[model samples]
Target: MKKIVWLSLVVMVLLVLAACGGGESASAPKESDGSASGDTASTETFTYASTSDVVGMSPILTNDSVSANITEHVYEKLFERNIETMEFEPQLAESYEIKDDNTWVIKLKEGIKFHDGTPFNAEAVKYTFDKLRDPATAAPRASLLEPVDTITVIDENTVEIKTKYPYGAFLASLSHSNAAIVSPTADQAQDLMKEPVGTGPFKFVSWTSGDQVELEANEEYWDGAPDLKKVVLKVVPEISTAISMLQAGEIQFIDNLPTEQIKRLEAMENINIEKKEGTPVYYLTFNHSREMNQDPEFREAVAAAIDRDAFVTKLNGLGVRSDSVVGPQVFGYDESADEAGTAYDVEAAKALVEKNGYGDKPIKLLTANRDNFILMAEIVQAQLTEAGFKVEIESMEWATFLDTARGGEYDITFLSWSNVTGDGSELLYPNFHSDNVGSSNRAQYSNPEFDELVVQSRTTIDQEERKAILDKANKVMIEDNAVVVMYHGIVTAAMDKAYSGLELDPNGKWTLKNVTGE
Candidate 1:
């Protein structure tokens, strides 16, 4: 039954791709009245193209990149990273303090109000978190606030969070757009995606499902009215189409431009290209709970057979080879962690397989039908077969692949980890911790000592102390053959020269709150 659904979704996705030309430009919407004009900085509407439509606005249901991108424009987090320095700064909150091991005392910034005119105060903070923590909501991001046991309002402008354990990354986590605070008066039970009200510089205006979304600048924004009056997010699922649209002047910006097309687009007179080192690690996972692939010997052999440099060069032309699950852009990635366990030694791989006495069992490799992943998986299959293991390949749609991978159904699967907090803890706990088994731990690999280290790192507020713990955990993970760290992806964006103030977050997001036109 699962296989049928997977095949059907693949067929539908292909049909959609076929119906639209892969490289043709899309037409832009007609300019709306009161849109931003070039003559003045105020009142401008910018049309932007993205490769996919947001799955939904509900932060709990899905963490789709497209949805998060659009939501960032309409929501405001308590803290945000400074564009120039990439450092955390207060936004909704004026300041905060770690008064004790498990307490975070926060002071709300005055004169700031939600788009709906509700006061942004301590009560609002408590209400927002309470809704997110409610089990009925099933918010996908609820895990982000797992440390907080309760939020207490000390006064109208003051609040305190008492956590079950000490967490140094709490403030960094708040900087994520997923942690955006919403108004308590805006229907606690409302469909957040369809109707979102926050203290952002822009307010949700309209959404044409699978087509476009519009936003209007908040004139009463505490910082000041946004320079642009309106913004339009156009969903164009094909990367080629997005680039073409930008070239034709129909769209002013195209996010996530494919590396292959970047060279061609660079020659265009009206486009501007921006490149940033991203913290996304694209790697393959082995189902350690499965009988055939779970053997440490077989896993290590497979890891040794594949060439990391080749994968990066062929599968991802613009990415850096990853030595750890945490990318170089992450805060605590140890430069000299471990490099002794695995190398592209096919002979060594074969010797290990023979030593394990797994004569010639065929291993199944799974990946989404996406272009790059399919190519990567096929290459891996070829490499493993050469090293004395029979291999079978399976391809499915992205959503189905995610479900099956999480279920531990595949012997091997292609996956990417987008660290939400830009911290080592985000990588350590989700994919390696025993408690996260059958969820983020698709590998089902566990080590009691490694788990303890992760837990200790999370509650340890000292930077150097947490780093030492995480470094040890990373070393354990690599030596155990838990999962192979492939490459850290480089994020690339192509925008019209007319658009400015576009910035990339460490999490591979492009924020447009301060974007302006020439």
Candidate 2:
């Protein structure tokens, strides 16, 4: 009976994968004759597999990479970052200037409209900023604008911003997806979390929960319509199934390419692989809200028990061993400070566990059931058990795991954060600040001095001064065992030979602005 149930479950997963797979059944633009058109810029429907499901489409609420990637195509920020030049280019705003140490004035681009036909003007920008600043909205990225005092509209196209203090990363932070401008109605509607209304190249079509989110190009876009008429972000959490779908021409791209399958995939005639240095930090966080994980000695025991070299090797070299919580790709990464944080020493870990009397209960390690995460958890479990600590692994779907971790339901959880803004302020403030306890600070870890340092980094205009302040704060967090620093990853993606011009930004965001199909 157990075998029958297992086989039935396997069959169900396969059926779902087959239904979600690519082929002629994929959504495409209809010709004048009401028939499916051939692969071209206008008719090709590109289906791409994602490793995790999107939490929600509301740009201000989600902090995950997958949601950011999807929302970016449907929403527009005031400014956009140029990957090649590393400069900010105007998107919704035509020009912006700093009037004083506490004031910024922005001129919005005229004649722009949301997909819902709402005018994109100074009022729209003000609405978005007001929503972000309101604590009732509970925006996860609200801390990005903690210094802003108020936003005032000077005219139809001009908006003035006054800050409580001098903010160094204010303009750069606006480029983040969380700062995406939305239609006034959409921002206030209950359905906005699921149905996004924005001014971008694509408009939200439909989202099949846990399966896929479909988007159609906005033909009336200010920057011109996208080349691909329809795009589907399919949730295929299994790497093996995604590869199979890619080969079968059911899916056009694979975002979570398995490192072990890279050699085999490269040998395929139709597959092209692209790689870039990732700005994400994959690490373990202890829920300081819970008593079991609150002890500094316990966190150190957990950190020292594992071998970083083995962990990297086990992932088939998909990432480099990260000594710092912040990746080297992000600013304010001090090598010497990170080196002094933690190291593998089984004897010391066991000694700490014994000294702290921490082996009385089992530590629940929560993680998503991804291939790499499970492997890492198993290795860590073995090491922790060897160090005389009771350990148990609890696995769930990616979305559920995220929800559980955010609710502080786990003792420890394996997670990764992508610093998409490429700024040191972004790296430190959200995850370490006490104000972010229920949001990005999954650890629920708080320290008064650490919080002050993070604020100091944001208030200063000098980059060197900000870096120095963060360096000291980072070292303090390490000493406190706020979280376990693991490794930095590399972004690996594979697409069919038919696709072109897909660019992966250094912050690990794939922009579809220039992607085209032949």
RMSD of each: 12.5, 10.2
Cand. 1 TM to true fold? 0.84
> On residues 200-300, what C-alpha lDDT tens digit does candidate 1 reach at each position?
87898888986898888888888878777888889776767776666666677776556567677766766677777887777877887877666778878
Ten contiguous residues minimizing lDDT sum, candidate 2: 33-42
Q: Model 1, which residues run further than 4 Å from truth?
A: 1-44, 83-86, 187-189, 315-317, 338-341, 351-364, 369-371, 388-400, 438-442
List the candidate 2 regions with Cα displacement exceeding 4 Å: 1-43
Q: Number of the top candidate by TM-score?
A: 2
Report the alpha-carbon TM-score of model 2 versus the true structure: 0.90
Clashing pairs in 2: 22-250, 322-487
- Distance from true location, Cα of 396 in model 1, Å: 4.4
Candidate 2 C-alpha lDDT tens digits along 1-518:
99999999999999999887745453444445432233433345888898678989988777777788789999999998787776788889999999988999999999999988989989998998888879998888888788999899999999999999989888778998899998887777656679999999999999998899999989999998888889999998778888877766667787656667877777655567888777778788888888766777788888898887777876566687767776777777788765766789999999999998888888899988887678778888898899989989999887788778879999888887777787777888888789899887877888999999889989988889988887888888878878777778787778776678888877778877678877
The model with the greatest lDDT is: 2
